[model samples]
Target: MSVRSLSATLALSAALVGVGVPTASARPATYELSGDAGGSKFEGIGYDARTQRYYVSETTGGEIHRGQLRSAAATEWLPGDGTDGRWTARGVTVDSRGRVYVAGGPNGIDHPGAPDLWVYDRDGRLLAALRTGVPNAFLNDLVIGPDGAAYVTNSNAPQVFRVAQEHGRWTIRTWADATATIATQTGFNLGGIVLSPDRRALVVPQGNVGKLWRFALSTGTVSAVDTGAADLVNADGLVQDGHRLWVVRNFSRVLTTLQLSSDGRTARLASATPTDPDRVLTTAKLAQGRLLLVDSKFDEPTAVPPYQVITMTPPRR
Candidate 1:
């Protein structure tokens, strides 16, 4: 279906479901992204609350698109066609200082001279791009740690990389390795990451196995999270507000909600909500009091344009 027709259908569906259309003065319910000729598919999203701008990554070619809370469309911020040695990009996050960190998924696995991640300043200037020096490393998603460093998840292995500027230079090092605790799987292992409510540990989901693990910030110890009987398979992006956590299962088309404990060791399944049936919602970020989800279009054999980022009301705890 064409973009216009698809949009109209979505509007009708929303209206039928009791979601009224936004007025002209209100923020747009959907933000359109520029299309790529060779079937562009998006995955990750990052929001800069300070600047009111959000970034989306194109998996087909590592291009980055930027949009604002007031705008209805996003423009390509960075070219992806092998620019800066990045052929494909995945997760993104903006730190307090406005530095943008992008995870290059499998970009450096077998390719020589490709970076595993890239860091850009607020003004879109390249700051650093370095490889994680791990074979078959698939850096999927990342989150800024409490110490202002980027903690990236590796899907190919049970490892988290610490990217930071120490002394005066930038460096990438293995911050935590849970090979003994978390076994390697055929598909993506550790996908989405978020900090606990108390900010003492990192909550990471093993997507392939539908399991959650807590990585201690102080000691880097890994422990299994007790998610009793909650099927969180294909969990992609995660958003946390207080003790409530929203897990976006991309292929499953369901948003699983969980209430975490103070220390982030255990979780109780609160609710499971199904998303839109048409779009495969991947990573999401909370901006302007709404949840902006990336309609990755991964389920499509050849993605149909124009691509989009959809908005929805966040689930209340």
Candidate 2:
């Protein structure tokens, strides 16, 4: 890393955060956020239903930072603890028991699994390590199912796989993989993955095309969910709340809300309202009807502002 990058990361190391509860509304609204100073670049994020806290990953290095969202732009971040100040924390999720599962190895593209996953408890204590089941494990993100299975996003093989608890450890298999619906549409990077409330469908953000893809487990087929998905609005991260589907599009820099079809066949805009968009996206259930979002791309290293996580209140439920 360059001096600029090293110095930026150190800044993040010394930064202090607080833990507090944020207020909510009938329907969620989006809240824009303050930008990151040096490094603080993020890869994945998740919401912890049990604690109402948000977990974010810093791909710049190890460190899946935890934040207590007290309100829009108001957050408390945990300190990085490990060799270089914590493991390489990326893509995040919280199990029903509230244990956090994070992709912590193979920091960038083309990198394969070297024990790519890590598990932590409510206090950020390391609990266990999970190897990205794939050979060239470039895990982008992950989601936990009702059965407690971990569905991880693999950016390399370009497919998602299921991780089950076995032999007293997390194991991966093709049971779900064989059941996935392949996208007829090609030429896009697949990142972020989330399941519908019904757990019958898996939704992913096709990073290159700026759209969301819904994978039907029962049918074994994939297709675009939004008419605007193939269009170049720059969709990045994803998450679902109740019947609401939320999307974050960069370039246009807007956060959109949609109503999901019961069958997971379609999603449509829920409100005329939209929030300022950024390079990164992810959703979390904070308080009952509220959500917390992080925008890692405030300014680009080349294009605009340095990356940072933002807070957003989705349209009121």
Whose lDDT is greatest here?
1
Q: lDDT value for candidate 1?
A: 0.88
TM-score of each: 0.93, 0.71
Looking at model 1, residue 209 earns an lDDT score of: 85
Give RMSD to native, each candidate.
2.5, 8.6
lDDT per residue (tens digit) for residues 1-317 in model 2: 22443453345335512111123343323332222345455556777766666677765545555654444332425444343234456678888888887765364332343456667777766666556455655666788866677777765544676777777775655433422344423433566777876788788776665666677766636676764432324555665777776665544545556677765667766542334322344433334555455555435563234334443445632
282: Cα error in model 1, Å: 1.0
Model 2 regions more than 4 Å off: 1-38, 71-87, 108-113, 174-188, 218-233, 271-274, 277-286, 302-309
Error of 2 at 159 (Å): 0.9
lDDT for every model? Answer: 0.88, 0.56
Which sections of candidate 1 miss by over 4 Å? 1-25
